[model samples]
Target: MDFVEQERMAHGIPSQGKITITVDEYSSNPTQAFTHYNINQSRFQPPHVHMVDPIPYDTPKPAGHTRFVCVSDTHSRTDGIQMPYGDILLHTGDFTELGLPTEVKKFNDWLGTLPYEYKIVIAGNHELTFDKDFIAELVKQDYYRFPSVSKLKPEDFDNVQSLLTNCIYVQDSEVTVKGFQIYGTPWCTIESIPSRCITALYDNCSAQDRKKLRRVVNTAQRITQTNLPSIDSVYTSRCLRQAANIIEDPSHPGHSLFSPLPSGRKSLCLKARTTTLKDSFYPAVIRLLNGPCIH
Candidate 1:
């Protein structure tokens, strides 16, 4: 069997590939539990809400919180620096080279060992496993495409979850950790050449619609349909007590909520209490096949 055929059999997914959705099952306490399906936001709508929600006010703040480490673009390169320690670890995307089972397993294995109360992972352009359906289809026809990828399978979803016991995978969803309200999304506009998954914008539309397509594509310039938020939109600590209506739980560790940071501010320091624990996060990093970051 060729590489494609061998790979097809190995994962039990079709040669054309498949799409997998992972819902995080969270339980703050035993009785109250919910499964979050927000990570797959771009593909599906929220069960009820039609519009994206404003970052909820009265967002909780878990007491005795600490540091948060944000990293991105590992590209199967987790061996370099010793990961920084924080209370929460946040990864943006590009978790794998081809989203192959082995690669995913390897990355997950590393992620699992990290010690943190909470870990958040969002998909990135390099995650080939996110589009398995396309790969399976190609293989069935015996026309193999290299570097083009596949999505996760139902069977493998558990594997992903198992690897990150403390992780909350957010596609287009939010999670409350310690006291922070974290929203995760694995989306960027960079195109993957052989991978139809990344070039999705052009896949369905026609050349005549290129202009329209450009707007829809996951380019860095326009990462999402909704524009990025502004810093003032978030409730930072300059007015914490008064902003209780804006923060969820202001006392928890790593209690972060996402809104836009100011134009020049690197990060917003929300008041309440500083979370000092050292946590490390791996964000999604795009791997270019031939060109610059795609739009």
Candidate 2:
């Protein structure tokens, strides 16, 4: 039915269009996309987890199979919170804490009363008015010190991703409905600055990767400056607590460890944290799409 088709990542080139997998064909087949997606970052192998014991949410669908309802940081709160049944919802963004176009039209009218046939949204780091270069560097700072970003006034957050229009809004794009090949990006990677840093809401970054996400958001406001490297000792709530999730091993079939993460990796290696999280994260709006290794 021609649900949706988008692939916009200009200046960095990433579009084999719809049935995509471009990153120079995932770097000329990186180990067949790392053994077809059981990609582990060897600290000496070891990866094959199969521990799934938790189910129930009106469970009743194994027929045509295809249920994905993953949500994340529902900032504007989804009101009552009772949305289980799924056939693809996957909204991995901050439904708006400030990307406000009346909160993206009330999150596109609550994603049009969700009966998900396909939603697939993305863009996090608190969607700050869709990062028009971080609202042009927070309107050159000092407006009574960002008071919730200068009590806003540019048409109360223009466009705001065209008010969602009821779904599919990926950035750095790539989407396909039923046959699924969904790729999304809110660009972030500073495992000590290899490059890239666009906290989504579009700007195809290149002010030298927005100055390495403002020097890792100003080195988490200093720590008596000491041995710092390996990506600024990772901050931003330890990059969302070293976010990692790779599942799909329902009693292990020909198991690629239940594949799902195969979207041309380029950055995000993060691995440094002992204790940190008292409001810091935007450590370039950390987002780590999972598919962590297992067998």
Candidate 3:
């Protein structure tokens, strides 16, 4: 296949048309039963060239199409708001205010009642209980200095998973539906200030927390390389530094960005968010356009 054909296939474009050919087999004896031959390619003419027009930058999605409704940072207020109808319902993270079992159960119960055909859920920084290692590290780091809340035991992870029966729970994982690939992660970059005050969702000032964050980022990169060659989109909780690194890296495959929900409980659509991702050597700022949003 030529490079153009490969690119076309990558973008799910169809060929202009196809041609059929026939073949005849020769035998030693004229009276012998004729052998059948099947030819899959045409030999007479050149292949047709199909050209797909590029979509305009400002084109609005058509109405009544396959819509994906996205809501995030609900903070355990699932029953208080009205949800739009969509083919897929995606809850980015922070469904629970305190990452407690009761909070998780309430979110799950509300998720089960949604009318969307597909539902995807991911954890947020508040969902510390969902990630055991994260919670353990926080405890070791004297997490009590910040605030005291219901701490989840190790076994509670299984119980939380069981409660989220109606939705697909994704933590550094991918799923496919109707040939569209969607990747989800619950990581967000940690912002640290002097005096050990860490913000930006997940805290990673501790060595163990850093290692776990790296593992999640590495897993995302590996999945992108192995399973996302033909992925249509990605759904992540927040744009962690690791995710931003993957997006800004030119060596990686191209991907679309989906903006994070606004800080409050406003029904805002996805828009591009710009951020600076710094490493040991290079520091760069890039703009990522939020992924597709249909509503």
TM-score on alpha carbons, each prediction:
0.40, 0.27, 0.44
Instruction: Report clashes for each candidate as comma-separated counts.
Output: 72, 4, 4
Q: How accurate locally is residue 294 in candidate 3, as Cα lDDT from 0 to 100?
A: 38
Q: Across residues 30-128, which tens digit of lDDT does each residue of candidate 3 receive?
A: 111111111222332223434446554335434424556778999987666877656788888889876777788888889888887899888877787
Expressed as tens digits, the lDDT of each residue in 236-272 for candidate 2 is 3234333322123344432332233355452232332
Best-to-worst ranking by TM-score: 3, 1, 2
Indicate the residue-level lDDT of 268 in model 3. Answer: 31
Model 1 whole-model lDDT (C-alpha atoms): 0.47
True-vs-predicted CA distance for residue 275, candidate 2, Å: 43
The TM-score of candidate 2 is 0.27
Clashing pairs in 3: 257-290, 257-291, 258-290, 258-291
Best by TM-score: 3
The alpha-carbon deviation from the true structure for residue 85 of candidate 3, after best TM-score superposition, in angstroms, is 1.1
Task: Kindly state the number of residue pairs that clash in model 1.
Answer: 72
Model 1: how far is 289 from its true place, Å?
A: 28
Best-to-worst ranking by lDDT = 2, 3, 1
Winner of 1 and 2 under lDDT = 2
